[model samples]
Target: MPAEKKAYPLRISATVLEAMQRWSDDELRSVNAQIEYVLREALRKSGRLKAGMAKPMVDDKPDT
Candidate 1:
């Protein structure tokens, strides 16, 4: 079974939120998803996450 994601309430300045929102739109990801992606990238760069640990599970869904 895959590990479940935990939710946390985050507080950030409006300016940062606005910037993140724009980046998220550009990346075609929800703001929450983009934030996770950024954090994951940083962790990988810092060597906190191993290559295997950084790989998110791919869900196979049929095209409509």
Candidate 2:
């Protein structure tokens, strides 16, 4: 089963939001997803999140 997601309000600069939008578009991901992906990577890199604890960014196969 997919994990549950929580809604949180975020305040960001317009400049940063624009950049993230472009990056997310380029990667074919929603801005929210891109942000989470970045945060997850950063956490893993900093040893705050375990490697095995991170969820896969994409599924191996399409669900039918």
Candidate 3:
């Protein structure tokens, strides 16, 4: 079975969004992807992401 995705509404100021775009491009990722990646990493580092938590949109790629 495939997983489903849920969309959320996010609001950002223009200046903050511009900075996010610049950093996202520098990191070779879309703004959304960069944000998801960072959040996931922080959760993992903080031990908040356990082995059986609800799946999120981050790193849905297959192992290569």
What are the lDDT figures for the candidates, one per model?
0.79, 0.80, 0.72
Candidate 1: lDDT over CA atoms?
A: 0.79
TM-score of every candidate relative to the true structure: 0.82, 0.81, 0.64
Question: Could you give candidate 3's per-residue lDDT for residues 1-64 as a string of tens digits?
Answer: 5456567888989998898889887877788877777777788879998745535555543454
Model 2, span 1-64: residue lDDT tens: 6666788999999999999999987877778888888889899889999878787555333344
By lDDT, who's the top model here? Answer: 2
How many pairs collide in each candidate, listed in order? Answer: 0, 0, 0
Q: In candidate 1, residue 41 scores what lDDT?
A: 85
Model 2 stretches with alpha carbons more than 4 Å out: 56-64
| By lDDT: ranked, best first | 2, 1, 3
